[model samples]
Target chain A: MDALTGAWQWLTTAANWAGDKGVWHRLAEHVQISAVCLVLSCLIALPVALWLGHIGKGGALAVNLSNIGRAVPTFAVLVLLTLGPLGSQGEWPTVIALVLFAIPPLLTNAYLGIREADRDAVEAARGMGMSGPQLLLRVELPLAYPLLMTGLRSAAVQIVATATLAAMAGGGGLGRVITAGFGNYDTAQVVAGAVLVAALALAVEGVMVAVDRLCDPMRGRRRAARIGRGPGERRGARDDDAVAIGGAA
Target chain B: MSVPWSLTAAAWPSGQVPADPGGPWLPQAAAPGGADCLVANDWICGAYLRTRSHELLAATVQHLGITAASVALGLLIAFPLALLARRRRAVAGAVLGLTTVLYTIPSLAMFALLTPVFGVSVAVVITGLVLYSLTILVRNILAGLDAVPAEVREAARGMGYGPARMLFGVELPLALPAVVAGIRIATVSTVAMTTIGSVVGFGGLGNLIASGLQGFFKAEVLTASVLCVLLAVAADLLLMAVQRMLTPWTRPRAGSRSGGRRTRATKAVA
Candidate 1:
C-alpha cells in the first residue's frame, strides 16, 4: 500500500532519527520510563502478593483490590495527577500512574503463581527442612517462574505500549511523535509512530519469552522426568497449559 | 452515612430519595486564580450542571454507545473464532496469538493506525476496541468449551443427544459462567479503554476529562474521572449479576473453595 510506503519513508528519514525528536531518543525515553515503572511495580506489588501467597492468606482480597485499581484507567489517573498538584513534578505523574496501571496483573499472577505451585514439591521442600524463606526462594519462586514471567511479560508489554502517555503529561516519548503527527495532520508520521511502538512491544515480548525459557529452573528436568507418561497425556497437559497462557493473554 | 441498607428501603418515605454525597459535605472552595471556571465549587455542582451537563450527557451517551457496540461486535466475531479454535489446538493457539498481538498494540497506536483508514469516526474507535475485546472473549469462550467435562459429553451422547443438541443443551449451559465472566471482563476493560477515544475527540465521559484537563477545571476532571471508574465498576457488577441470574446451573459446581478462588484469580488476571 502507498500508505505503508509513505510510513516507511517517514520512518526512514535520517533526520527523523536525530535531535530531540528522533525516534531513537524517544525509544530510549519510552524504554526508560517503562523499565522504571515495571521495576517499581514489581518491587511494590510482588512482595505483598508473594507474601500473601506464601502465607496462604489474603491473596483474594489483594488481587481484587488491585483489579479495582486496574479498572481506574491509567489515562484518567495520569490526567488527574498531571493536571493536579503533581503536575509540575515533570514525569512523576506518568511514572506513578503507569506503576499503578501495571500492579493488578503483577499482583494477581504473582500470588496465583506462588499459591498454585505444585503442592507435592512444596510439601517435599518443607519436609526436607527448608525454612520459609529458603523454600520460597528455592522451590516456590522458581516453580512460580513461568506464571510470574507471564505476568511480567503482560505488564511489560502493556507499559511499553502505553508509555506514550508520557507525552500527554508534557514528558517525552514515542507518543510525542504521534501527537506531533496528529497536530500536523501527517498520516504517514502517525502510522510510522504506530509501527515503532508495535515493534518495540513485540521486541519486548520476544526478549521476555527467551528470558522466561532460559531462567526457568525446572525447564528441561521437569519435562524429562515426566517422560514416562507415554507422551499422550503429557502432550494434552502441555497443550492445556498453552491454553492457560492464551487465557491469560 | 446514607447507606441503602434494605432491599425495600427505597419504598420508605424518608428513604425514597436517598442521600447524595455530593450534598453539603463536599468541598466548596473556589478555584485557584487562573483556573478555567469561575468558582471551583460551582464547577463541582451548580455551575457545572447549569452550563456543562448537556455536553457531559452527550459525551456519556457517546461513550456508552461506543462501548456497547464494540463489545457486541466483538462477541459476534469472537464466537465463531472460538468455535473454530475449539476444533483444534493449533488453531486455538494461532487465533489467540493473533488477538494477543492486537491487544498488545498500544491504544494510542491503534487510534493512529485506524485514523488513516477510518478518519476519526465511530468505526475507528469501535474497530480498535473490538480488536482488544477479542483476545479475552475468544479465549474465555474457548476455555469454556474446553471445560465441558468428558463424562458429561459421554452421558449426553449415551442419551442419544446429537452433536448440536449436546453442544447447545449441555456444553453451553456448563460453559455459561466462564463465558459470562469473560464478557464481564471485556465490557469493564472496554469501558475503561474507551476513555482514550477522547484523544481524538470522540470518547464519552472521556471528553469531559480531556476538556477539563486542558481547561484546568479540577471539578470537571475529578467528576469525569470518578464517573469513568463508576461506569466500569457498575458494568462489571451488572454483568456479574446477569451471570448469576442466568447461569444457575454453574453455581453449585463453583461451590468448592478452589473453584471459586480459581474463578476470581482468572477474572482478575484476565
Candidate 2:
C-alpha cells in the first residue's frame, strides 16, 4: 500500500515536471539528435545502396556488414568510440553510433528495391535507346523510391528510440530526465519521460505512414490491408498459387 | 645561377657534403624493447584482466539472459497474436500498428519510463525488450503464415482437419522459413537492444562499454564492442543453421528445379 502510494505521488510529480521548460529543452535535444542521426545515416546509406543496386555487386557484403552493425549494440559502440582516441563523449558519439545503427535498413531496402526493379521495364527502356544512367534515373529510381522510403521510415523511428541511450553516456535528452528520476527514485519522472517518448514515436510513425500514403497513393490501401493480414494468410494464398503454377510449369 | 651561400648549403650542393645538420644523421628514438617492453605489456595486460572480468561477466550474462527471455516472450505473444490476427484482418492490422508504434519508442525513454514503474528490475528490462520484438515477430510470423498454400489448407480441411491441425500440420511447416526469418531478425535485434537494459542497472555488455567510457578504459571498451559484433554474427549464423534444419522442405534439392519454380510462384503471390 505504501509503495503504491509512493509510486502514485511520484507519477503525479513527474507529470507536473514534464510541463516545465526543462522538459521541453530535453525533448528538443532528443529530437535534434534523432534527426541528425537519421539524416546522416540516410545520406551515407542511400547513395551506397543505389550504387550497389545499380551495379548488382557487393550487395551481399554490404548487407552482411549492415547486419553486423545491427547486431552490435549501439550503446556499446557509443561507449567504445567515446573512450577511444576519438574522445567523442557527447552527442557526436551518439550520432555516429546511431548512424552506424541506421545503415542496414536503408542499405538493404535501397539495394533490394533497385536490384529487384522490373527487368522488363529496363529492357524496354533500353529498346527505346536509353543510356545506362538514363535508364537508372528514369526507370530504376522511381520504382525503387517506395522501398527506399520504407527503409528511411524505419531508420527514423529507430534513431528516435535509440537516441535515449545517448543520455546514459551523460549526454542530454529526455533520457537525462528519466535517468535522474531513476537515481532519485522518482517514478513519476520516469513514467513521464517514457510516455513522452511513446507519444513522440507514435507521432513520428504516424507521419511516416502519412508520407508513405502520399508518396505511393496506389499502394496505400493495399499496403495497409496486406500488412494487416498476418503473413500466413498471404503465404497460404501464395503457396496455393505456387502449387498451381508449379504443376503448370 | 648565383644562389645564396646559406641556400646552397641548405640545398646540399650537388655531389658535395652539405653544411646542413638535417639528414639521416638525426638518430630516431630507439623503439622500446626486451624486458622493459615485456614488463610494460604484462602490467597493461594484468590491469586489463583484473578490472575487466567482473564487468564482462555481469554484462554478458545479463545481455544473454534478457535477450533470450525477451525473444521467447516476443515469440510467445507474437505467434498466437499472429494466428489470431490472420483470421481478423482489422484486428491484426491494429495489433501490428500498435506494436510498431511501441517499437519506435526510443529504448532509453522506454527504460526511463519503465524504471519508475518497475524500478530497474529484470521484469522492466524484459518487458521493454519484448515490446520491441513484438512488431518484427508479428510481421514475420504473419508473412510466414501467409506463405502457406490455400490448396494445402483446403485439402487439410477436406480431410476434416480442424483449424489447429491445419495450422500445425500444413501452414506452420510451409511458413517456417518466413517465420524463422522473422525470428532471426528478432533475435539479432534483441541481442543488440539488450545493451540498453544496462541503463536500468540490469548490467549487460552495455555496462562494460559505459564503465569504459566513464573510466577511460579503451581496452575494456574495445573488448566489449568486439564481443557484441562477434555475438551478433554468431547469433545470425546459429539462427540460419536452425532455419535450415527446421525446414528441409524449403531447401533446394540436388538436381531439381522444383525449388526455383516454387520460389518464383511464392514471389508472384507475395
Candidate 1 positional error at B237, Å: 1.2
Candidate 2 local lDDT, residue B205: 67
Which ten-residue region of model 1 chain A has the weakest summed lDDT? Answer: A240-249
CAPRI tier of model 2: acceptable
**Cα lDDT for residue B159, candidate 1:** 76
**Which window of 10 residues has the lowest lDDT sum in candidate 2 chain A?**
A240-249
lDDT of 1 by residue, A15-55 (tens): 99999889989989999999999999999989988899899
Model 1: per-residue Cα lDDT at residue B203:
65
Model 2 residue A13 lDDT score = 60
| Residue B8 accuracy (lDDT) in model 2 | 23
What does candidate 2's lDDT look like per residue over A1-249, in tens digits?
444455456546644445543677788888888888888888898888888888889878766765665676777766665655464444677777778777777787678778877788888998999998898888898767666676777777667666766667667776776777666666666676666666777787688778866776346554565577566353334322211110000
Q: TM-score for all predictions?
A: 0.85, 0.78
lDDT of 2 by residue, B16-81 (tens): 212331235333222334224324333134344433454455456656777777899889999889
Deviation from native of the Cα of residue A112 in model 2, angstroms: 1.5
Model 1 alpha-carbon drift over 4 Å, by segment: A225-249, B1-46, B252-270
